[model samples]
Target: MSDDPNRIKALGGGSLLIAWQLKDKNVLIVGGGEVASQRVESILTADAHITVLAPASGLHPRTKLFIELRGDRVTHRDRQFEGPSELDGMDMILTALDDNELSNAIVKMSRERRIPVNAADIPDLCDFYFGAQIRDGPLQIMISTNGNGPRMASIIKKRLQAGLSGLEGQAITKVGLLRNKLKQRAPGVGGLLGRERMKWMSQLCNQWEMEDFSSLDDSAMENVLDKGWERGKRVPKPSELGISRRSTTSKSFSTTSLLLPSIAFFTGAVTATLLLSYSGRR
Candidate 1:
């Protein structure tokens, strides 16, 4: 292998992050241990129909709890994984058996059936590895070391979650709603206009600092839509944006708030902006 970063990594040596919309998809798990329990929790997020093929006595307490709680979607077969017949109709397979022979048999059958499979602690044999994840409702961050450092990935995941706001999940939900409203109001089209519209929306998002969401500058947001938006690609300043907090009682003390052109200044900061634009054009 050449010493280029662009070099294609060998199989099981690379990671491409994606979310599976496994709602109603059949997922067969062949184990009763802790690793199997983890896989059960991970796939449940996608609302998959899960079947655990293990004797009831062997099941991890958590795995049994999951089946009990989500009896509508999750099932415990209380039987050993049979032949290739077990792989039939299964969309995805996750096996955490202590028996290497059984795990390998399932891997081969899964391959022959063209099913994606992941064997516990067996990176080279897995079609995918479950990374350490942080979920903020619709926003999910998965940290992976390409199956090399699960422990490190978990540490990083915890650190990131600690730094993030508790309201981040709710904020994402609000932003998604806002996005939907914008799509309806502006109605994006194709070609140059479409690209420009997309850029404008992106700039709109960029204009909102983290503090903006916490103590949202409602008037400034309106002014950006009303005044600043006509200009393409230029992210407007706080002074130019006419910042005002939605709350009167509590507000974030920030440099941008200090810089906001006051009502005695430029609440209609557009006037100053228009003058600037006119002068520059001349």
Candidate 2:
């Protein structure tokens, strides 16, 4: 393990930071204790198809309740994890067992199968961590300290949540509706390209003052969106709107005005559409 707090190199020495969409994906979880319950709760919102391999009698009450509430979304094998065979078709594996030997064994098995695995409280054996997350409807902010300082991540997430307004969520919803409407009404508009759309959306979010959606009723919001789209159609270059193309193309855009409304609305809608497309897979 490296001494650097921001980096966690797993057993096979691979390091990468990524967000996996587990919707309708097969996930195998070992153990039924408190830690496992916590992992389950964290991923429940992801809509993953989960199967737990643990002794039925040893399952935690909370875990049982979660399975019951979710109905068919989750299933239990009612037996202890045997070996790598349980991971044959799994997209990912998670272990929350106190037994280090068993967890290590599972990690080894997962590695041989090229499956990503997360071992609770065992950063050295984990491929990823369930970092703190702040979700406001279609808006989501994830805070990660690599595999260290989870408590600090939670604290920062809370602080961010405190500074965020509920109207931001409503703004995201409104923007999403407007984007969909625009796509339907003007499918061939050049302003709808990735970079152009981002530039225009960012400008619109700033111009409309997305901090409060209550200020604009449905009609007013539509009118604003119409005007923004008109501006987008007219502005051949981002400089025309006082925005640089580099700003729109950067990996992380500036959050000076409305705080990620443009990027969040675009990415969130794509994610939602993908989830809906995969919903029927399982």
Candidate 3:
């Protein structure tokens, strides 16, 4: 958490970043305005069972669309949220009402019930902030200034998006497939502990070019992975691979490291072009 006043005001101080698994959990949402609608979009991706309590008259268009699209996954209660009783059996609660008093009341009730609550635009009242994110298939990068600078986070996300290429996503998928296969082939293995496994995977990534993997057909890809697995099995210890135990435990490869140099060059080009244009205007 950042101590910057703006970030603290946006996200609150002492907030820990975490990914919640909301699949099939009941989430209670109070209000049906645009803010609530935005919350709905965020949670819906997690497959949470949602109940929105808001008057039937003033539902935001996006909220209405969510109800329509989600159908049985979402239930709409055509009434105002009265009190804490609504928090019963909910895994999480979100309040997006225009009334600060009502939002504060709900937050207090949620506290008493021990349910996590997020009050839209009220960092002090929220348990967590919806930080900016960039998704590349199964790989996701989340940026937060502890709620201080969301606009800055968004700008960074765009820069990263421009810098990264789709090849990295394919590489992640390939790596995941290889890991699963290795785990299945050598279950409860001694040599392939966390650190050793990471070392082997890192070496595999270093040895195999992304272009080579991309050019391969499904069968060829499997052959390449199988050959890598065989080589990994032969190196029973990290020492055999010339990687000391300390080195293996100290460092880990990041998937983002797979981004091609060409992609980075392009990103730099784009940034330079923008700077040059601004300088000309000045």
Candidate 4:
């Protein structure tokens, strides 16, 4: 390998970007300001149980509404933070207080207690920084600058959005459904049939290209699963199945594709079901 100064060396002393699995986990937010509310939205999507610990007078209007509406997932303390006892048994901590001294105190106490903490707008004291994300159905492209440049990450996210396929999410949805059907169709011993299913799906995605996924009609899907596996034969393409290629720039799922439920949710600055729309040129 050529020695390049710009090469990725190590994660030493720098942040490692990760998708934290927070479902059903408990998280504590030390402040109820706007930034704290923003934190709630991000963590809320992870299906985590969140408690905003700040007096009622300090809560941002939007934050209050989220706590009120999403009561199933959120709750408020309605009082100012006290001390170390408040930080007990927390899986994670987020500080959005304007009080620097209090922020420092919480960060120090959290470090002592070994809980991961994120101090908003104070990168130096944070253990994690939220990154920008581009969501399309089951697909996500996460962008980050290791807590150094959030704005830059947003810029990259927008660029990716512009170039993404509008029907890509639909394609992914169809492909995922086909995978489930394939699993039910083939059930051998432990690793035996699983390998075959994975190999075929890989080949399908690799050979057909992304947009071609949307061209797979019901008949084509059946032919691929049935005849293709009959003689240990290869899966047929949409063209071979007598289907015409779809426009890469098309923004909607082809009428020929399976009917998918349109499910999504969006709120201020938080995208729960951001199956974003995009289309590429043919």
| TM-score to native of every candidate shown | 0.72, 0.70, 0.71, 0.77
| lDDT tens digits, residue span 148-259, model 4 | 6878988888888877766688789879877877777886655967888888888878887577777676766777777665548477766766667666543344532433
For residues 221-249, could you state the per-residue lDDT of candidate 1 as single tens digits? 45555565545446566556555434221
| Position 74, candidate 1: lDDT | 90
lDDT of 3 by residue, 1-282 (tens): 678898767863445778899999999999998988888887887789999999979899999999998887899999988767888899999999898999999999988888999988899888888888876666767788777788998998888776665555665776677676656665665663755666776776676544333333455444544555566533233223333222111122333455566689999999999999999999
Off by over 4 Å in 3: 1-14, 189-198, 206-218, 231-282
**What TM-score does structure 1 among the candidates reach?**
0.72
- Which has the better TM-score: candidate 1, or candidate 2? 1
- How well is each residue in 1-282 modelled by candidate 2, as lDDT tens digits? 578655544344333656679888988889988878877876777879888778989999999998888867888889988766889779989999988999999999999989999988888888787778877777777887775688898998878776665566666887787666656655655643755666766666665445434344566545655555665443233233332222121222345344668778889999999999899686
* Clashing pairs in model 4, backbone N/Cα/C closer than 3 A: 165-278, 166-278, 166-279
**Window of ten residues with lowest summed lDDT in model 1:** 244-253
Worst 10 residues of 2 by lDDT: 243-252
- Quick one: best TM-score, which candidate? 4
Where model 2 places Cα greater than 4 Å from the true spot, the runs are: 1-16, 189-198, 214-221, 226-282
- Local distance difference test, candidate 3: 0.75
- Model 2, CA-based lDDT: 0.73
Off by over 4 Å in 1: 1-13, 188-193, 214-282
Any residue pairs clashing in model 1, and if so which? none
> How does model 4 fare in lDDT?
0.80
Clashing pairs in 2: none
Assess the local accuracy of residue 262 in candidate 3 as a C-alpha lDDT between 0 and 100. Answer: 64
Model 3, residue 46: what's the lDDT?
A: 79
